[model samples]
Target chain A: METKIRQLSSNLDPRYFQIVVLSALLLYGVAILDFGIRWQNAIAIMLTAQFVQLVGTRAVQLPRFDPLSPLITSLSLTLLLRTDDVRLAILAACIAIGSKFVLRVRNKHIFNPANFALVSMMLLSDHAWVSSGQWGSAAIGAFALACLGFIVLTRAKRAETTLAFLGCYAALVFGRALWLGDPLGIPLHQLQNGALLIFAFFMISDPRTTPNTAAGRILFAALVTAVAGTIQFIYFQPNGPILALILCAPLVPVIDSLLKGRNYRWEQPKGVL
Target chain B: MRILATIAAAALTVAISATAQAFCGFYVAKADTSLFNKASQVVLVRDKDRTVITMANDFEGEVEDFAVVIPVPTKIEREQINVGDRAIVQHLDAYTSPRLVEYHDADPCMDYRHFEMSMDSAAPQAAVLEEARKVARSRGVTIEASYTVGEYDILILSANESSGLVSWLQDNDYKLPKGAERVVDSYLKQDMRFFVAKVNLKEQSKLGYQYLRPLQVAYESNKFMLPIRLGTLNADGKQELYVYALTRTGRVETTNYRTVKLPSNVNVPEFVEGEFADFYRAMFDKQVEAENERAVFLEYAWDMAWCDPCAADPLSAQELRELGVFWTGGRGGSKIAPMPAQDVFVTRLHVRYDGEHFPEDLMFQETGDRQNYQGRYVIQHPWKGEPSCDISQYQAQVRERQEQEAQQLANMTGWDIDDIRKKIPFPEGDAPVQEPWWKRIWG
Candidate 1:
């Protein structure tokens, strides 16, 4: 049964699985959890992201337009980016798709598309914010389970990044609590955040934007954790992981150059290292 | 269309009772901070990096026994600390409290144009100086500044270590709670200064004030948070904290913990109007339980210019400034002005927490969401006047509404449904006709 399931799964692109999982989470958030996400904004983001992806493909003269990448990005933005203005939502979609085509280093994107758009929208206007704490503990528990299933379905090809980032983040949070003489519940509550889970499993674990080597990815995770801990603990700011990711994006190419490994392609379905 | 007619009829009948009602509903009762024992109220007025914090001292004991040790982000100087008027804080509380409002259902028999009407409805510290500094310095503690503001003697202390600070406070007869040493050390490690205030009985007696006024501090820092860890050190099982944030942009919410908006705009049984305080406490306890006791609840978030029901006309510009809203122009505007103030948004957050559930300080961020919200429960009085036409359907609908309200009350407050049903008068007669179970199942 396992062999047959793997055989069936190997034929499909992992992006399809990610898309399904993200859509399911988005549905749960909207319908059951009352995440206060506007349907019009979600629709606008989906359409705008796909349209921008099409335009970028035509401009770059690619063989064909693949809607999966933009669809995943749109679902991510719909799940994370919050704004009262529909125009801002459209702008987020445009920036997310447009960055993939424009910002390149060594034929690879510098930053994760959704991370770039979320951080940019936050800096651009006060209207947009990420409701990191909107997901209660029960929702976080369910989402963590879904993320674990996602790693299984994808065959753990790029699971190293998520694991390394989560491990380092938990260490830092717990370490801080220990030093402060606080109870274990403090760090546990911090780790149970849905936004943090999404960042680890979706944003930071994006193989396309991460380093091409395992050693490089681990080093990258450490750096992001250091910066995130500073922002959260020292400066007492919200959206630490997102802000840290954008800040650390420029260093990925440097890591790629130093470590020297084969680049990842979603269709390859091979080991990351 | 039929539902609309029934609602109109309910409203018309409500007019016969001759009690005032408004768009939000007629003001009945409120669940203010006083509802809970050991409830602490803090007002934060913030814009950009500037923050003015007024800590209300609800310390219920001898003035000499009242002492507060708060962890502040920046060092506070003598000029930065002031004694605030207690009345302003009370006014702010009344303005942002969760309110219960009632509406009258109109007569189903009479045809009247639907209309709207509205009506307006409605701590101490002491300490000593100089020689105390000598004792503090011996304990590796630096007394940043000291001031006698009104009836309170305030001190700003920065310590090299938590043990030294705790010991220094203890030596000075400041009665530090157990497990506070570690918390102080943590704050010191994080580069936070301590604001300590105690009542000066000599000065307090000279001032002839019966109660201790709130202590206000103005500073510039990026950390927008309330230090609740030390408060949790007390033996109290749980502490209630109400934080009223006055900001320029929009609603303020917690970053680390989920900020859930209290259930609002809900229709409830009319009996709730009399026991609003009990109803609110029960509903809040249930909400806290529902969120696993780790959530901060938003009770009210609205523009300070006006209110739909005008709980107590918006605070005047003078009152706003007294609470440290520095950007509201200059001087007092006309007291008779219809609109009292603007450009200030107030957000009321209530948190019932303890050390076990909340380990870290309460951190906040001001969002651009200007959407207005309030903890408003509605009680629509059923029309009791005689009807000129056949009104069995109206009565049936009213009965259904009453049952739904009872269920809603039960669900929200975790009250027994039977007890709720007992409390509700429930429109008389026109019981919902029950279909035969066998025929229905067969069909």
Candidate 2:
């Protein structure tokens, strides 16, 4: 028994293995529920992409089992697709997954993967993103997002950034509704239909993309939230998340570099060997 | 042989030069003196490429592009001219840019003459035919044996046949060529295909007032101006009026009316006797009264009703119930109802009038219950003290019921609810209906 345990542990660390398994399950589960028969092609492409990223780059360094990528891709495919539009959904998922790596600056992705994919599809192709799944179904996705949030929060991912993003988005939507005398309920409902919750908890709260200092992260998230909200209200376009991320992503590196540069000196811990 | 060839080449050169001078450039001539003045400028320029004309002006800046320029006639210019004014120029141009064109005096042909004739003598049909034939013969027109409209004798005449008539009538001098027969034929065919049947000739007579008046008067009185003139005699001396109405289907409904006057006016020449004068006067008076009554009703109802004058029919108690009105019987042997009211009230009631009084149509009432007279309640006039206790309280109640019925109809469709609400008569002030969230999705 001891030998078996050792052998299992040596092959792949429990945490890393858990992450890979959970990610795979999440991707397949979302594809089946949201895409049904269409998920066959999507799963194939997603696995191929994941394998390539893991083997080719050797940069699979998630510390905790975070399901942000799978959740986002699933939510995007589910919310912004019709049953027959499998090819487009797969294309969108690929763009979203690939964007995290391709459209990165320095150490972090420049835009939210799902948001980047959605905007690129709209600009380049004739495909549209439509809502699916019942409003009640959001509870499940929200719970999963909360679990992911716990992992990210425990790993020093800033909570204030997520809060700021949510706060700014809510305020802008409410303010515009009041100004235009439109029904306020519609915009509020829209927040739950897209990959908004996942982005708020996991993508924006990414440690590398977020500021190290609490106040800096708060400012970054607030700016991103404000930009996204403004794009949605003013242009009434669906590129809000991408726009928000693009606008705020650069600030993270600048902020991190500033904080780290200022506090470079390290003191030895008393209990360390 | 070389000398002969050179002579031939010189002759060809001279012929080409003369042709170019004759056809290439725009011509400038006074409208009264111009040979082409009789033809429509639009027709003259039709299908002719690369042809442009400009009006002679003292102002020498960049002039805007225009389609055509019509010169106000010398008479109008003299009347409207200031001391330094050369001529009054009427600019007709393409919508994009103003391209000023040559100006000449107004063509006398554009001024239309109004004439009216009524045949009410014994054998009125025959009288109309006889009058038409006489007019055709006096004008030297050939009456085609096969060309007979129902109760109307039509004569086909070439410009030459009617040259004497043209000489007599100043406006008729601008005669179209024989080719214009096709234009007239095409217009008649299209017009006939799209014509709306006349509902009531009497009501139409009243409607004709605004049309027969002076162009400026008619333009001011009506919200929309029809492209065609009304109460005008054609070259055939037939009095016809055209009414254009926009239908619910978004197409124009044109109704034509032949002038029908009292028997005394049949023999008189329409232009001299002013046959359409009474028709105009009557129409204007009725229109004014109708407008005033509408304004008063609108003030009380707080909104305008979509009343179709042609659809206003009297109803009995049973018929009223079918129309969705709740009813009760009353003293003085009258029927009444408590009607559902809305924010707006529109009624298309058909009523028959006897002198100054309008009696209800008993057939619309429900039978069996003598006391209530088919579920209707009779009541005193709401505005009995008002000077025009003229309109019945029952009519008002009917209007309210009609509004409620319309509202219920709109609720079923889930679309145009607001518009339907606006059109109904509500006793209470404007209040929006609060639909439950679940019902919004399901219902």
Candidate 3:
């Protein structure tokens, strides 16, 4: 019985776990937190993403079609993106999946699909925005726990990006507090935000889009954090990390070329790929 | 795309307490904001980067003792400062305040029709000059600009350090609150300038105004936020703030903290009309607690063109222009299209905050959502005259509704359920009556 359980855990891909967790969070948000996500829009995003992914697979002639990636993207987009028009939601789904095929370098997508779609939608239409404070601080504790569990479940593979990003971000916030002579409570309150957590844990920490080497990932994390801090404090804008990730995505391939390392694949075991 | 932002009907809570007859029902009393002590009101008109802010205070003390220090995002010159009319702010309060409405039930034996009636309810000294200047200069404080605008003397100050600013304020007889040094230092590091105002008694007498009017300032910056940190430095237990945000787009909400809509459109007992002020206070207290006292409550968000059951008439273009809405064509400026041309969206946000839960200042962002939301509560009056035919079913349903209203009131206000039920005048006939439990067993 123990060996059978071990076999299931060992052979199962981490994306399945990600899909379950993201879906669960989505359920919690829509059901309990009043995220204000419309049901029709959620359906359109999911279906449009899947349809685009299928067409992209056929056009590229990949070995096998995988629906999990698009499902994950759809869930992330629904969780982050807000718009009154269903057509815009559908358009966002198409752009998200389409970017994975068109914007590739060294056989890896440069930007996280959801991040690309969100930025594109914001630039393309004025009706779309990200409600960063919708998740309120009351749910931060439970959310942090879920994210920590996710890190443990993934065996900490490429977890350096999440750690480094959060560490650098916290240092910058606290440093600002000290410089301003403000109370510690101010920065503490700022840090306890759900949107920032979502960005740190799920969006920026995508192993496929991050650098291949551990050292390269840390460097990339610092770069993104610096840009994000500038945008938020200097420019006085919201969703700094989200906008920063898209701006910094193109540098991943450059970093990978400079510091040579093995590429990441979901199916392959460590040291084999 | 012309997006019509209409809120869910279920969430329709309108708060118009002023005595105005509009909509389908007769207007009644409203929840007066005077129930809150230490309350401050601010009107912000924002478009892109240019912002005009009007700060109003109800200082009920000797006019000579009134003074205020506000942190501004940019340097203000004389043209950027203006004294606003107090009546306009009062009118805005009446226009956007959460309202109570009454719906009289039609005769069940006769033709049935719904009826609703809407009703609405509605600083400091200064210091010396040349000797103060040397001290201020030594303390790294720069009096950037000084102007006398309509019964008040205003000084714009920039400081190199917080200590200098604090000492300068103290030397000038402005009592600095404890722990204000830290807050002042924080603002200085951010490169924010201070707008200091004190009543000019001679100018006040010349202007023939008894009470102090609000202070207005206009500046251009990317920061769409209010500095409440310095206000929190005082030992006041809690402060109530009403922010009336006028924007060109849809609604404006706090980006840093959660902005939750206040409960609206719920039916309550008939007695709520008398003590709506109390009911509003209790309901607001309950909501603040529910959100853990860390949220900004959105009381009203509507287009300025018109209102269905308006608490008061929408502000005219002339009035809106006075409140710093620069988009509208001003007096004699080719009076163009009348209604849609006044593209001003007003959002009313109320918060009871202190230094603890609300550690940081409020940060806001304008969204594309144009949904009109209001904090409106409803009450229904039962038929009083003699019925022409049998109305047994109607009375039973009315009793059930009364019970529901009782439970809802108790749930929202944390009031005792039995006490609420005792107050409710439940229907007399055809209502279910409780029987002794012993009868069921013994009989």
- The model with the greatest DockQ is 3
What tens digits encode model 2's per-residue C-alpha lDDT throughout A189-265? 44543256655764576555566666677778778877887665444334465557866776777877766644221
Q: TM-score of the candidate numbered 1? A: 0.88
Clashes of 2: 38
Write down the lDDT of every candidate, Cα atoms only: 0.75, 0.31, 0.74
Each model's interface RMSD (Å)? Answer: 1.5, 28.5, 1.0
Give Cα distance to truth, residue B34, candidate 2, Å: 66
Once superposed on the true structure, which residue ranges of model 2 sit more than 4 Å away at CA? Answer: A1-37, A58-97, A100-104, A128-156, A177-194, A255-273, B1-443
Error of 1 at A257 (Å): 1.6
What's the TM-score of each model vs. the native?
A: 0.88, 0.31, 0.88
Candidate 2 is scored at a TM of: 0.31
In the range B1-443, model 3's lDDT, one tens digit per residue, is 11101000111122433221111000011112111124567888999899999876555445565556677877777678887776667667777877767777883332211223322111221222211232245578878667677777777787888877777776664555467778778887887878677677887887677766777788999999988776665423766777889998778889888888877889989888777777888898899998899999999899988865677667767667778899887553221232332688999998777789989988998877778898778788787778998886687678778878988888888888877777777767322234354643554
| Better-scoring candidate (DockQ), 1 or 3 | 3
Error of 1 at B112 (Å): 20
Poorest 10 consecutive residues by lDDT, candidate 3 chain B: B21-30
lDDT, candidate 1, at B80: 80
Which prediction has more favorable lDDT, 2 or 3?
3
Q: Write the per-residue lDDT of candidate 1 for residues B297-387, one digit (tens) a residue.
A: 9988999998766455677887788788999973566435534788999998988777788877888999878899988777888888889
Q: Candidate 2 falls in which docking quality class?
A: incorrect
Q: Write the per-residue lDDT of candidate 1 for residues A1-273, one digit (tens) a residue.
A: 999987877766777778877887798788766767999999999999999999999999999989999999999999999888999999999999999999999898998999999999999998999988787655456466546545643554777778789899999999998897777877887887887888888889888888987778889999999999999888878999999999999999999888775545545566543
